[model samples]
Target: MDTTPIAAGTGHAEAAAGGGVRVGALVPLSRPGWVEAGRQLLAGLELGVGDVNRGGGISGRPLELVVRDTAADPAKAAAAVEELAGTGVAAVVGEYHSVVARAAAAQADALGVPFLCSSAVLDALTDEPTEWVARIAPAQSRGWRIFADFLLGAGHRRIAVAAEPSVYWAAGARILREHLAPRGGTLVELDARALGPAALCDELVAQRATALLLLVGTPEPAVPIVTSVRHDPRLADVLIGAPAGQPEFAEWASLLGGDGAAIPFLRYLPEHLSPLGARVEAALRERLDEAASFVAFEGYDTIAVLAEALRAHHGTRTKAADFWPHVTAEGTRGTISFSRQPALTAWQWTWPPIQVADRDPANPTRFRVLHTG
Candidate 1:
């Protein structure tokens, strides 16, 4: 199993001569996971690792990634962290699923290993505060609140969410509910599993919801629900939304085509990229053979921050005081840094830039920024 990152530029031989700084990457690459998202995330992580090596190999030592497939399973993530800890990785990074990241974060903290979580937005990553883990993504509450605000701006005072059972979805619903209630808005929850696409549409009509938000899985219920609603005569004026970012992947457009556009979702990115962000975005497009999602940028920024922290602290792994204060790096999105937040159980980025965006109906591949926060 060659679990090495794709080396970019001309520092391979030099890097190899100085041994490698091992970082464990937990990604969901197979079935039951969002494979496309995992691939994009890995591309960014690998690109960041390559750039670090090219910039003199993390203090003259090669950086290597030990990859593990979580498959969106929390148990697998926990076990992978245990294995990675035993294998002497300086830190663990990269996970797109919030539940899986929570499991990995717990395991990493238990084993006293540092984990710079790449893209999980769950508000409470741990039950309590611990320095063993920090995150690059905004908390679910923060992002969802912004998403809820977008809905309000669009005049959706009566919103309905077809939500599946999951801590992530439940948390998002709660955030929307809380954020909306005091602002003269309301959120109505619908059981996604109990309602077929037709039933879901009927309920949307009966509830008189101005907008229908999807807090369900992609393709199965979400795609079908969108299709049903888009085709339904009674729901013609109802807006469809997916704030958890289902439409950010190419698969959504492939499956839904024109029906998938204009469905707003949350993404962590500035309207414009920094110089470093633009360069990385170009490289990522070439590397991915498609436009990269924000999750991928999170992965790349994870490595960039970790590499600088490692260099500042002599390439050591898992030291809270050492890495926490030294992680200011020029990321693809914005200057990345971490601080303790009241709402999060992990050290948060205070927030990465957040946006509410959607695919242009005329061009499914092209994203149009609808709102920024």
Candidate 2:
């Protein structure tokens, strides 16, 4: 229970004295970005550790978490990984930002430590040939493809993509275009960064687009865009899709108020909840005192996967390459397998489950799962 802040340069002699397996958790705890998300991930990490410790703790030895604050910066994230390596953590987990996770993965590879990326969806994160890096979340391209399929299956021919100028959004927009074009569908690309929300909505309506995809980076732009489109009577039939960015958060529905109703978004886990998922959600809700998000579930699952691998190896520090086979075979969310295709790297979770969900008008806290793939 004693979580004394360990300085970056400190030795791990004290932490290892009790024969516990130290696991490093790298998250953006400081400000300037993603503070809430980092906290939620940490909460899940702690809960998973608690559950592991309760159930005889990894070959009867306790699991200790060494926390490091990445502050959402790539350089800091890389440094955190190096520091965690020096501190002698058996493995590392928990990074929400894609850029930060990419940098940290490189550091972990160099250090020869296993890194379980919790929520970063960048395709290139797993594209590099590194045995040290593994991802529990699906790649962004896969999520975009899921969204594209959902839109097209609903008989939508004309699709419009409104995206901000960022690597994540750009990648998503590109995937949408490629998938839709081949299926005899047309895509209208709009730069939400260049145009205000009202202007973007006006342009989308003018295009007579049957489906509008918002790939904006944050909720700031998405809120107004969804609100504008939902309120307009002219765009009543248009399906407004907020893929990957804002709608994933639990706060999105409350922020958008009634306008958030019936707007579909890409979700890794279903809101209706599986039995195991319900138990995890209940624990998180008790700890956080509010509804838990998908990121929290991801954080818990990352640790669960790592613990499963560790237990299989009898608490020994397994090599990154050796560890993933066990993970792919025994992962909690079905089988956490990977593909070695050239487009994807060795550690990418190839068979990740995805769903298109929209908020319930009567209960903003719950999402109605429209389609699962």
True lDDT of residue 102, candidate 1: 98
C-alpha lDDT of residue 158 in model 1: 97
TM-score versus the correct structure, for each prediction:
0.96, 0.88
Candidate 1 has an lDDT of 0.89
* lDDT by residue for model 2 (250-352), tens: 6776687777777788777743566667888898999999888778878878877888888887766676668876554433355566555456553876756
Residue pairs with clashing backbones, model 2: none
Model 1, 1-373: lDDT tens digits are 3555434443556546666787899998987888999999999999998898778867777788778889999999999999989978889999999999999999988999999999899988988898889999999988998999999999999999999999999999999999999999989999999999999888888899999999998877889999999999998889999998999999999999999998999999998899999999999999999999998999999999999888886677745766675578889888888898886778888769999999999999999999999
How many steric overlaps does candidate 2 have?
Answer: 0
For model 1, how many clashes?
0
Model 2 CA lDDT for position 94: 86
Cα TM-score of candidate 2: 0.88
Give the poorly placed runs of model 1, Cα more than 4 Å off: 1-17
Determine which window of 10 residues in candidate 1 has minimal summed lDDT.
1-10
